[model samples]
Target chain A: MGQRTMSDQELVQLYLTGQEKALAVLIARHQDKLFSAIYVLVRNRAVAEDILQDAYFKIVSTLKGGRYNEEGKFIQWAMRIARNLVIDHFRRGNKFPTVTDSEGNDIFTYINIPEENQEDRLVANERDSKLRQLIEQLPAEQREVLVLRHYADLSFKEIADLTQVSINTALGRMRYALNNLRKLIEKHNIAL
Target chain B: MTKKITQERIIQFVYGELPFEETAALFDELDNDTEGLDYLESVAGIGTLLGSLMVSPSKAIRDNVLAFSAHFTEE
Candidate 1:
């Protein structure tokens, strides 16, 4: 409470010790990355923002009540909270989070492609469309792994830890994802 | 007679999941093999472009988050 510069772990300690502002700092530190994670799943900016706020509310109340473990892995714990909220939102909306659209279309279908005649630009656009379509075609399990691993920048170990899958299992899903994408590309003759 | 790399390994490599040593070997292979290099570059480019397509949340959304969090401090 006295302007003490604290590490995230120390901040968590302050929150547990009844200093509320410390909790605010912790939330601010994580909000952007956490929101980005939620947004990628929900793909709805408003919904992601809402979930982020709700996550903080839950984190604060839960921590102040001594319900949090001080395992020094507080970011991951908060991430778990944000992940649950995203899942709940999906369930409540009845839309599979990775599916983008209920009709099996890639959500990026609405993405506007800027016009350009350069060979590089044309190829890049074609590739972008193919990639989105391929990702949409992936099984939900594989898609989740790819998104969390690449888009969210989670390590394989972190992904396994978060998803509760073994490391090899996570890696396997990623493997299937790539194979499936290649197959889809070949099958569709998408000129990437 | 070229060995086939699984689509999974290709994705892993594109996403930077391959081990450093494996990556160096893959890089060498890609440099010497036109087909392999083309395929990898295409897929990696697609991955990059798809991710860049999303618009960052607007300022209104950011303000909403700030407002909501402000409730705790306003007390």
Candidate 2:
């Protein structure tokens, strides 16, 4: 079977045995979800890219050092690393990530699906940036729950375990997040 | 008697985290409740919007990572 079709565990084994592409396959499989998950929390493209790169190096280091315990999903482990890095960024900045970067650019665009025209692309970018700002405005806890559940691809139970809360608490936070986002959209009249 | 479908349950249903049986149960319970259905739509609607907002790392960044992986053992 092709490495692309293999399970993550199988890929890890192949990567261990000197197949570099196996590692590439694994990164391709999870990068979008992982990067997007981090981006949502950190709220900046440049910083998210940095965290993702650092997370990749950390992931490679751990795998090479024979320290990764493959008891759970690989993405979950990577998610934890990226998450801690984002938290570190928050501590360093002494606040939640601002929506814009140093030069005031919000360059969050999909990796695939190229836009047809500059006007349409600009419009979409503006709308998406507005939505992300609204997301930034969510209460931190609720936003965390939303990112963990939606972007991290974690179940509410997994989120509860990660966040040290009950499943009900996680679920409640997600519900609040959705409702709050709805209100934000209405209040701001965001097109999306 | 129908169990009242809570927003939390709707949230799970919307996210596809709810089990099939439970989803069918909620699907049935929500069939007659316009407000519940609308709430489900709102949750799902926002989720779709959020999904669209996701961005990918630039190609150069990914290439750099792949290169890092390629020579990781040699370094």
Candidate 3:
């Protein structure tokens, strides 16, 4: 099989063996999810993009510096780095950006959905946009849990550790996220 | 003895975070209660909808990261 078909672990091994393209392949495989996780927190495309690049740079340096020892969790490690950068950015600024600026533009504009039919695609896109809006409407903590769980693909335990909350709190936030989303779907009659 | 099934437990069950025994217990409870089953379906459906949305950084970001990766080599 080609490098395209290699598993993440295989790609990491290949990169370690001096095949630079393997690193490219691995980044391609995870950029979207990593970017999404960052955007969910920063809510600004430009800032998220910068943070993603910085995170990738750090990831490469870590790999080269022999500091990255996680065998099959390169993506998770990269995500943790990106998340920390985002937190630092906010902490330094001492203010988190609003979910949307006065112009109401947000990262959801970057979502690209694929579907077979034009009508179905439009409907699906609308549903997705509505869902995204609802998620943005969720309380910050709830949205953070949901984003970390789904976008970052972190476990509830990891989320608890990262957010410095108990596992029950993390799970509770996820439960409330779902419940609130359900309420919003019903309230708005969103067909999903 | 049976444990009470809260929404938190249902969320854990939906996300595959529950232990196998708790999962089995939840499944048993759901098998007996239509409302519980429906609630689980609703939660899971929202999850499915959330999963359908795909967000990515712009092409510029992807290209920049990939280009940087391509040029880096461990010395």
The sequence of per-residue lDDT tens digits that candidate 3 reaches over residues A5-60 is 67887887787777888887787789888887887677666787889999988887
Query: Which residue ranges in model 2 land beyond 4 Å of their true spot?
Result: A1-4, A94-114, B1-5, B73-75
| Each candidate: chain B TM-score | 0.67, 0.79, 0.71
The residue-by-residue lDDT of candidate 2 on B1-75, one tens digit each, is: 122347888888878888898988887888888888878787888988888766667777778887887777634
> What lDDT tens digits, residue by residue, belong to model 3 across residues B1-75?
122345777778778888998888888877887777777888888878877765777778767766776676666
Reproduced native contacts, each prediction? 0.14, 0.70, 0.70
TM accuracy, model 3: 0.79
Candidates 1 and 2: which is better by lDDT? 2
After superposing candidate 1 on the true structure, give the runs of residues whose Cα lies further than 4 Å from its correct spot.
A1-33, A70-75, A96-134, A182-192, B1-13, B28-36, B60-75
Over A49-146, each residue of candidate 1 has an lDDT whose tens digit, in order, gives 77877887777667655577657367677778888888888678655333345644445434334545566555554565456556667887888777
Model 1 Cα lDDT, one tens digit per residue, B12-52: 68777788888887777677777776667766855664455
Lowest summed-lDDT stretch of 10 residues in model 1 chain A? A103-112
